[model samples]
Target chain A: EPEVTQTPSHQVTQMGQEVILRCVPISNHLYFYWYRQILGQKVEFLVSFYNNEISEKSEIFDDQFSVERPDGSNFTLKIRSTKLEDSAMYFCASRLQGSEGYTFGSGTRLTVV
Target chain B: QQPVQSPQAVILREGEDAVINCSSSKALYSVHWYRQKHGEAPVFLMILLKGGEQKGHDKISASFNEKKQQSSLYLTASQLSYSGTYFCGTGPSGGSYIPTFGRGTSLIVHP
Candidate 1:
């Protein structure tokens, strides 16, 4: 079975530095999404992308956050300036349709110090 | 809004049954079920759309009640492998593309 894969399984960055988390969603999936989970917290939706554009985003996805599907298979999330709170397990997910359940990547653990 | 999951944690013995509930404050278009083992990605189990649909996988089953904005996952005759954190992701009505997941219910099944 094809699965969503993410690069840099774990990352450590300085508090004010920029960070990019990369993901390659399921080959045939269309809708792509980014979610984050703070240690011991529920997974929170960050943004949803379709047609190479952002469909929806949460409050947490503020000015610092951006997503790009630079290529056919690569989906990337960029944080312009990281904050301590940005440290979390960032997950990339994709689904064929709204009715289908999403397949999530193993996740990229971002650590800011 | 985030869905509320009941019974933060549960412990069950092999061959036992368990039910986890998820309730949302807003109207929902669909509810998705997923299971995540420690340190691993979440695996999709099933999705229940509006109009009161029920979907199941093997011995795991789930039901979505749009009228009440709630969903429930049923694990019957559970095995030790069923131990994990189960999440209910809710897609609100009005074409909201992002699904908000509940806090998750942690289940520990023992042999």
Candidate 2:
């Protein structure tokens, strides 16, 4: 089965530093998404991307955060200023056209010190 | 709003049957089921759209009750592989594609 690949399985950064997380979604998927799971909390949606632009974003996706489909297959999430609370597992997911199911990447564990 | 799931956790022996439930306060356009092992990505199992439909995969199946805004996932003849956390993601009946996930139901299947 094809899989969505996320780089940097684990990353630790200073609280005020900027960080960029990368992902390669499934080749045929049309929709891409970024979600986060804080320790001991439910997974929360951050943003959804389609047609090379953002389709929808939650309140958690603020000015400090941005997403880009920099290349045909690569999707990225950049956090301008990481906070202590930003330490969490960030996941990348993709959906094929006309499909309700989403395939998620293994996730990158972001830890801000 | 996020959905609520019943039975925070469950432990069963092989071949036992178990059911996990999810309910939402808002009307649903679809309900999705996924299972995740510890420290791993969630694996999509099935999706139940509106119209109170039921979907199945292997011995695992789920039913949606559109009127009640609830869904149930049933697992039969459970195997060791079934030991994981199950989550129900609810999508509101609108253009919102982001589905809110429940807290999750943990299942432990013992020998």
Candidate 3:
């Protein structure tokens, strides 16, 4: 089955540095989302993107976070400045329609030091 | 808001049954179920929409009660392979596309 794919399975970055997590959603999927899970914590929603715009975002998705669908297949999340608290497993997911369950990528583990 | 999952963890023997509950304070449009094995991505199990519907996959089934804003997952005749962390993602009323997932219920089934 077709699945969501993310690049850089793991990343280590210095605090205050910018990081970009990339995802290639299923070719026919229309809605894309980003979620994060701190170690030993529940997965938290960050943002949802549709039609090249943000549909909704959580408080965790503050000024430092932005998402872009720079191309037909690529959905990218950019963090302007990384913090220790930002270190977590960032997951990218996509759904073809409002009715289907989402397909999530393996996830990119972001480590900030 | 995130749903509250009951019984943080449970252990069952093969051929036993298990029930995991998820409750939300706000009205929900839908509830999604996913299972994650250690160090692996969560795999979607099923989705239950409003109006108290139920969906199932093989021996795994789930129920969503819109009136009570609650959902439950039922694992019947469980096997060792069923061991994993199960999460319920809830989408609140008013078209919230982003579903908030609960902390998860860790279940272990031994042979």
Candidate 4:
């Protein structure tokens, strides 16, 4: 089975620093999404991307956050001036055109000190 | 908007059965079920697109209401491996594929 891959399984950064989380979605999947889980809390939607542009975004995705498919295979989320509250497990997910089911990456645990 | 999941947590013994319910205030286009183990990504279980549809995988099954506003997941003859958090994601009828997930239902099955 094909899998979505996320890099830097765990990252710890200074509160005010900028960090980027990377992901490689399924090869044939067209819709990409970013979500976050705060510890044992609910999974929160961040943004959705398609056709090299953002299709939808939640209030959680503010000006300090951005997502990009820098290359055909790489999807990245960049957060600037990170705050302590930014610490969470960030997940990347993708699905094919028909939207049968979503495949999620293992997730990157981001911690701001 | 987010869906509401019932019985935030459950404890079951091997060979027992359990049902987790998810409800939404808005009409739904599809319902997706996923299971997540500790410190791991959520694993997709099933997706129900049509209203009044029911599907199962192994001993696990799920059903979507005719109104498309609610869904229920059933676990039969549970095993130890069935222990994890179950999430129900809902997508209101539209062109977008983004799904809003419910909080989650924690299941602990012991042998």
Q: Report the number of the highest-DockQ candidate.
A: 1
Residue B102 miss distance in model 4 (angstroms): 0.8
* Stretches of candidate 4 exceeding 4 Å from the true structure: B93-97
**Considering just chain B, what TM-score does every model have?**
0.95, 0.95, 0.95, 0.94
Name the 10 consecutive residues with the lowest summed lDDT in model 3 chain B: B91-100
Measured with C-alpha atoms, the lDDT of residue A19 in candidate 1 is: 98
What is the alpha-carbon lDDT for the whole of candidate 4? 0.92
Q: What TM-score, over all chains together, does every model reach? A: 0.96, 0.97, 0.96, 0.96
DockQ of 3: 0.87
lDDT of 4 by residue, A1-113 (tens): 89999999999999999999999999989999999999999888899899999989988999999999988999999998899999999999998864577899999999999
After aligning candidate 4 to the native by TM-score, how far in Å is the CA of B74 from where it should be? Answer: 0.7
lDDT of 4 by residue, B1-111 (tens): 789998999999999999999999888878999999999999999999889999998999999995748999999999999999999999863445577899999999989
Q: Which whole-number lDDT from 0 to 100 does residue B13 have in model 2?
A: 100
TM-score of chain A of each: 0.99, 0.97, 0.98, 0.97
TM-score, cand. 4 vs. native: 0.96
Q: Which ten residues in a row have the lowest lDDT in candidate 2 chain B?
A: B91-100
DockQ of each: 0.88, 0.85, 0.87, 0.82
Candidate 2 residue-wise lDDT, B1-111, digit = tens: 889999999999999999999999988888989998999999999888775799897999999998999999999999999999999999863567578899999999999
Arrange candidates, best DockQ first.
1, 3, 2, 4
Clashing pairs in 1: none
Clash pairs of candidate 2? none
Off by over 4 Å in 2: B93-95
lDDT score at residue B51, model 2, on the 0-100 scale: 54
Superior candidate under lDDT, 3 versus 4: 4
Q: Residue-wise lDDT of candidate 1 within A1-113, one digit each (tens)?
A: 89999989999999999999999998889999999999878888899998889999988999999999998999999999999999999999999986788999999999999
Candidate 1: list runs displaced more than 4 Å. B93-95
